[model samples]
Target: MRVSMDLELKDIPGQLVLALKPVSEFKGNLISVVHHHEKKTPRGKIPVHLVFEIKPDHLDNIISLLEESGISVVSVDEKRYLEHGAVILIGHIVHTDIKDTIDKVDNTGYAEIVDLNLSMPRVNRPSSASLKIDAVSKQHMSAAIELLKSIAKEKDLLVIEPIGIN
Candidate 1:
C-alpha cells in the first residue's frame, strides 16, 4: 500500500529525522520526502510532504502512532474535506478558566486546538484570544466551535465564529 502524508514539523535540528523515524517502526519504506525550510505553513510550522510504501495492515497503526506522537497529519490519500477553522474568543478568557475551555475542545477527539494567541489588558480586565481548530469534517469542526461558543456563553464570554479570510 502506498500512502502520502502532509506533516508539519518543528524547524529544529533532527525534527525531520524524528518525523521519519515512525515509518521504520511501522515497517514502511520511505519513498520520497519534500521538505520546505524557507516557507512555513499557515500554522507556522515546517511543511513536509512524505510518501511511503508499507503493508496494508500496518497503515492504521502507523497513522495512530504519528498522531500519538503529536505530529499533525494535514492530509492523507486524496480526501480533501478535512476542515481548518479559527475563532476569536473575547472577554475574560484567562479568569474564566482558559485551560478548562481548551480541555473541552481537546477532549472531543474529533478536533484539536492548533494555535492560540491571547492578549490581556490588565488583571480582571477583558481578554481575547484567537484559536485555531483542526477537525476531520465540517460538521465536527462546527460542533467543536459550537461547544466552545456554548461554554463561552455560560461563562459570560463572547465567541466570534468562523473568522475566515476574505
Candidate 2:
C-alpha cells in the first residue's frame, strides 16, 4: 500500500534524516520526500511531505518510530483505492432520489461514488446519469456495481454497465 504523510520537524539540522530513518528501518520504499526548509509552520516547525510504499502491517511501527525520534506527524493518508469503474443509468434519476442512491453506495465503506454526471434533456423525459466509482479492490468494485444494478432495478432504471468490468 502507498502512504502519504505530512510531518513537522524542529528547525535544527539533521531533522529530515531523523524523520526518514524510521521509514527505512521499517522497510518502506521511499517514493518522494519534499522538505520545506524555507517555510515554517505557525508553531515554528519545518513541514515535510513524504510518500512511500510499505507493508500494511509495518505502517504503525514506522509512525511510532518517527514519533519516538521526535518527528511530529501532522497527517497520514493511506491510498487504498486500487480499482475504478463507471456505469450509466437511464431513468428518472432525480425523481428517484439520487442522494439516497449515492448514500447506499458510500455506506458500503469499501466503495464510493467519486464522480457523477447527469443529463436531463427535459423535465418530463427520462434522465441519464454517468457514475464513476472507486474501490479498494476489484472484488469490491464488482460488488458495488452489482449493488447499483439492484438499485436501478428497484427504481425502474436502465443500467448500462461497461464491458469486461468484472
Candidate 3:
C-alpha cells in the first residue's frame, strides 16, 4: 500500500538516519522524505514527512518498530489510519485515572480515543464521559469496543456501546 507518514525525531545528529532505518528494514520502498531540519517540535524534536509503499501487513510492523526505536509516528494516511466510533462510560471515571483508561485503547495501535467529553456532578458522585474512538478500520472496531468494555469492568465503570443510534 502507498502511505505517507509523519514522524518526530530527536533533534540530534543521526536521528533522521535512525528514523529511516525502520522503513528500510520493513521493506518499504522509499519514495521520498521531507525532513524539516530547520523546524523543531515543542519537545525539541524534528518533524519529518515520508512517503513510501509497502505491504499492508508490513505497515503495522514498521510503525511499531519506529515507536520502539523512540520515534513518534504522528500520523499515517487515513486510508489505513482509523475509522471513527463513539462510546460512553458512566461511573467513577475520574477516580480511575482517565489517562490510563484512554491509553489502554490507544496503546493497542489499532484503536485510539480521539475526542472526549466528561461530566462530574459532584466530587463524591459518579461521572460520565462520551468518548470518540477511532479504530484502524471497520474490522478493528469490535476489538476496540471489547477492550473498552474490559477496561470499564476493571475500573468499575459502565460501558454504553454503539453510541448515537437510538
Give candidates' CA RMSD values in order: 12.8, 5.3, 10.3
Report the C-alpha lDDT of model 1 over 98-143, residue by residue, as the tens digit.
9999999989877888899999978878998999998756777889
Task: After superposing candidate 1 on the true structure, give the runs of residues whose Cα lies further than 4 Å from its correct spot.
Answer: 1-81, 163-166
Q: Model 1 clash tally?
A: 0
For residue 13, model 2's alpha carbon misses the true position, in angstroms, by 23
What's the C-alpha lDDT at position 113 in model 3? Answer: 92
lDDT of 2 at 27: 87
Better of 1 and 2 by lDDT: 2
Deviating ranges (above 4 Å) for candidate 3: 1-78, 163-166
lDDT of 1 at 124: 78
Candidate 2 Cα outliers beyond 4 Å, as residue runs? 4-62, 65-77
lDDT of 2 at 104: 97
Model 2 worst lDDT run, 10 consecutive residues? 79-88
